[model samples]
Target: MPTEPATYPGYRFPAAVIHHAIWLYHLFSLSLRDIELILAERGVVVSHESIRRWCLRFGTEFAAKLRKRRPRPGDTWHMDEVYLKINGELFYLWRAVDQHGVVLYILVQERRNATAAKRFFKRLLVGLKYKPRKIITDGLRSYGVAQREVLPGVRPRTSRYLNNRAENSHKPTRRRERQMQRFKSPEHAQWFLSAHAMIYGHFRPRRHLMTAGQYRRSRDQALRIWRQETCARVVE
Candidate 1:
């Protein structure tokens, strides 16, 4: 689907600067102040507070645009959940990825029970627009219950050994979580991670599996898409 142009009316900085700040914040482990300094070094004098506002305003918008450009996810889906602490309270971060490590969706919930698993499953089915042929997950009993209720026909494979794809996907989130000193709240974690998954997933081609030439070409293509998506004409 073609993306309609976006406008940055009433903003002091240009859209490119806003996009740059957001991209930097999500694509790397940089604090708001860190991003502010980096932009200043490049002669773009914006405050860290302004950077924070830009991310809150436009990060998900940008992610939606990029997701629209993605191909359909693979038929084999992998799901996993990890505990995240927000304000010293525990929340579950449920994530799903395809066999190729492309993120499907993320949900921040208070429980990792059958209810939560079912909710995540339904969201993924609706979001992805199709049922996956098979779901891979760890030995979470909730998955078995949720699979029956939500996606009965789809095969569910249970075993820790088979779910490395989804588990490995958490590594980047873990890194970013530590870098940011943990999320302030569940809503905060959801927005930041939802954006992170899309942006990071776009550029993170499996270089280990590709030839050097293939990796370069894939990277160049990703860069082109990022440029086009961000630098396109903004309506007034």
Candidate 2:
């Protein structure tokens, strides 16, 4: 196992509680206040502000560690974009996922035009180590333009119903958005959602496709990986 960073030193609480709070915030539809209440009932009283600070500081760190441990992206990609409202204005959240629903990248932008599509493509290519063999997307003309420019050789398929994998991945974000009563700002949305995606992908196995025994095994493995990556000494 790769050594995680040194334990966080500034916190008064143990690493386990701190990590648990962060995990609950991202892994479920719990708001900061909701988490604070849950912890309060459990006899661990922490302010919601402290939970927010922990998420802001340590969420990215945990995401980076999990991303480092994830398997390579699958060869086929399904891409989609959804609109998110921030401060009464609409913005697009560009998301790409593989065939198995592993998220490739998510970007929040002011437009869903060709320029935005091209930027998302570039970001995915630069961040991921491998190029996709084929791409599936909705009948979005911008995807064609960006694909031709950034990945000229890959096969691109445009279909209305075939890209549901990418579209379905947005449900968690929607639920969380509702739980938190919408995002405060674009940067805030991006930071929280990106880290949320990483943590979600780690714990979420394809449960419908697995038998009970397999599901249990997969879940145990996911938890083990999370502990190893986050350097958490306690598992709840």
lDDT of each: 0.89, 0.90
lDDT tens string, model 1, 102-210?
9989999999989888888888777556788999999989999999998899998998988999999999999999999999889999999999999988988999999
| Alpha carbon lDDT at 53, candidate 2 | 95
Model 2 RMSD in Å is 4.0
The estimated TM-scores of all candidates read: 0.93, 0.94
> Model 1 segments beyond 4 Å from truth?
1-7, 232-236
What is the Cα-based lDDT of residue 105 in candidate 1? 94
Worst 10 residues of 2 by lDDT: 1-10
| 58 Cα displacement, candidate 1 (Å) | 0.5
Off by over 4 Å in 2: 1-7, 232-236
Per-candidate alpha-carbon RMSD to the true structure: 3.8, 4.0
Candidate 2 lDDT: 0.90
Error of 2 at 150 (Å): 0.3
